[model samples]
Target: MTNLQDRYGRRFEYLRLSITDVCNFKCQYCLPDGYLGDKHQHFLSVDELRRVMHAFAALGTSKIRLTGGEPSVRKEFEQLIEIAANTPGISTVATTTNGYRLAANAHKWRQLGLSQINVSLDSLDPELFRRITGNGRHQKVLDGIEAALDAEYRKVKINVVLMKDLNHQQLPAFLEYVRQRPVDIRFIELMQTGLGKDYFDAHHISGESIKQQLVALGWQVQPRGPQDGPALMLRHPDYAGGIGLIMPYSKDFCASCNRLRVSALGKLHLCLFTECGVELRDLLGNDQHQEMLQQRLLAQLQQKDATHQLHQGLTGVTQHLASIGG
Candidate 1:
């Protein structure tokens, strides 16, 4: 069981697989105009995705996260979940969704061996939520959150993309929400990805500012150990659950990156900010060259960029978050 280790000494044990690039909402920061058209519609079949998971599991991968514009919107999403959860070496299966369909499927997800769930909930206010997602499904999302809680999932988390002058004021409310519920809320620093550069420039808020505010409020921050992803986990003595901050800019978040993203079209993204990738759809299901394909993937993993260059003010990001499965 040789694990996939990168040049920077980060072992890639978690795989973020984008089952589809299509999404229901037009989140201002993710997909401004909804799903990318036909050109981006190419997606991997469920069987192909299963085989890919098997390949990664054989390489010592133990966790697989299903991501997408909205993984719940993908057809036969449960089957995909089951596949990864049942994979030989994979021990955990998780999904990051917009919570549109979570309410209806939360129970099924829990029974399917899904150890964790992360739902994106930026704003609690209905109108503001609609404005942020560009869709009037705020009530549904809230209902989904409630349903997730009702499902009694082992790990339920809410993801908040903190944007300046947008949903930043909701941080306190989020903290309160987590205290009342068993779920944890994570605040992700707004990233400068493709297709949303203008929006990011206008709305990007540093997680550091939010953290300072929390500290000023007398919140005692207790450090938690390694997380499933890149978030910096903190426990507050006053708060019931944990709070996670993913600071990609102020900190060198890429230095400890331990995951790889596979696009819906079967392209491997060693880094979320980079467009460089290795296509693997053609090699799926080919036992004759499976070893060769694994070697090729290992080579690419070894070549992963030491760190994301966005921190240095570099531009030219052409991959949108929706397309990259963030």
Candidate 2:
């Protein structure tokens, strides 16, 4: 099978498949409130997700990362992981979860061949965590992180969405927390997409400044391997773990964007910040010819935006991160 390559010659091998949009947390920037109204109806079943993975695997997709409003909230979470890992061409299967219920399944997830697990933890302080996530499940997330480490997955990463004046002050503490553990800490720049322009303008923090601060704090930072997804990986000599800065706004993270996102409702998002996509669930559900589906997918891949224009402003995008399976 030929690789799925965009017009820019970027081969798309990574697929961020959102299992479900339902979530337990209402993180201010992700989902200010609980699950959005009626959007969960579009979630794909276990079989559907499996079929989607098989199609992508045939098209040379080597890596699959399951995301969601909170992926663990889905009923078929474990089954989906196994499906992705067992896919013919997929080399690794990973998932990003809020960690609210990860402790209960971390061991099982590792047994299912989940290569890596990324848990979102913004602050070390319990109170601050509660404020950030709009819930008091900070301890649960910590327990989940410990469970993943104990399960001995290849890597366990912590995702911190940096927001000005909101958990931003805890950067040093977050670094220290990961230094002692065998986990990678990723600091994500707040993206001005779907969260409303007002909210983004108020809280968005630059990843560049965060990286500079980490350097001043004596962390020997460097770029990670090409395989290390979009995150700008850095390491400190004294720490057991490394630091990753996902600078969505600092630079053109889209030049090498070798990924395609499929939302829970079956929409194929060419780029995270771009609203352009094709409705893929219909084709997959209709039992259309595999070659036909592949051609349609390739067509959309060619239409993928050269680079996300979030820097220009969130003029056209209105869907929240949850709806899009961030």
Candidate 3:
């Protein structure tokens, strides 16, 4: 099949899939406390997730990212990654995790053909970190990072969600830590949604701020490949790999958007800001829907929006980040 392009002239072949809605942490931004799955909440069984994966892979998706509130928290997470990685035409298979259990599970993931790991590490400050997550175990996350390095995983990227008047003071320290490690660390701007808007300011610290500070520290900010999305992919002059800034809310990458999302319960969302979706859950009734499902997915991509504009009124931004496949 030809590379599917949107009306904006960009291809739509990458997908981020949320395998489950379950998560272990109560991170104020992603999943605040006092939240519980009510009677209406639905989760995709492993087989159902694979069916969607097969359908999309057949439609020319080469890269699949496994995400969840924490995908690693799922019981058959490794098997899911293995299936996606081994799928025909799949060039890359990766996952995003909070890293609490990484130390023990990185090898398991690696053995299953996982390509890259994007782990969330908000702060090195244990107390502040605990407050942010509403859970302890900062050391566990740190250990998981080290274990990924020790296991010689192909690439390890640390995702830091930047919040003002909170952990902004620790940015320099975070950079210093990445400078010594082989990993690529990215500073992601706090997104606007749910508890995030109430907990964080709309202002996002730019890649320029990070570049300037790196220069002050005597490190040259060298650019990296592709240069898509929120990450201002850059390498350091003396450091081994690089540092990245994914300032989405501060610097939107709406025009070059090259991805789609499949929610945990078989809903396909075209944009992060769009509220409605193309429900594939009904297709679960029969294998006859596979071909039609592929067509529906393509039709949805044809109408993909150029930008999220999430900062604007979120009257339609209903799905939680986890449910929407972050």
lDDT of 1 by residue, 61-117 (tens): 888999987898877798888888899988889999998888888998888878789
Instruction: State the lDDT of candidate 2 residue by residue for 172-262, as single tens digits.
Output: 7887787689899998888876556788889988899988888888876675565556788788888988888888776668776778888
Q: Score residue 129 of candidate 3 by CA lDDT.
A: 91
Q: Name the regions of candidate 2 deviating beyond 4 angstroms.
A: 286-288, 315-318
- List TM-scores for all candidates, in order: 0.94, 0.95, 0.91
Prediction-by-prediction clash tally: 0, 0, 1
Candidate 3 Cα deviation (angstroms), residue 18:
0.4
Which is the better candidate, 1 or 2, if ranked by TM-score? 2
Displacement of the residue 319 alpha carbon in candidate 2, Å? 2.0
Q: What local lDDT does model 2 show for residue 169?
A: 91
RMSD of 1: 1.8
The better-scoring model by lDDT among 2 and 3 is 2
**TM-score for predicted model 2 compared with the true structure:** 0.95
lDDT, candidate 3, at 180: 81
- Residue pairs with backbone overlap in model 3: 230-246
Worst 10 residues of 3 by lDDT: 221-230
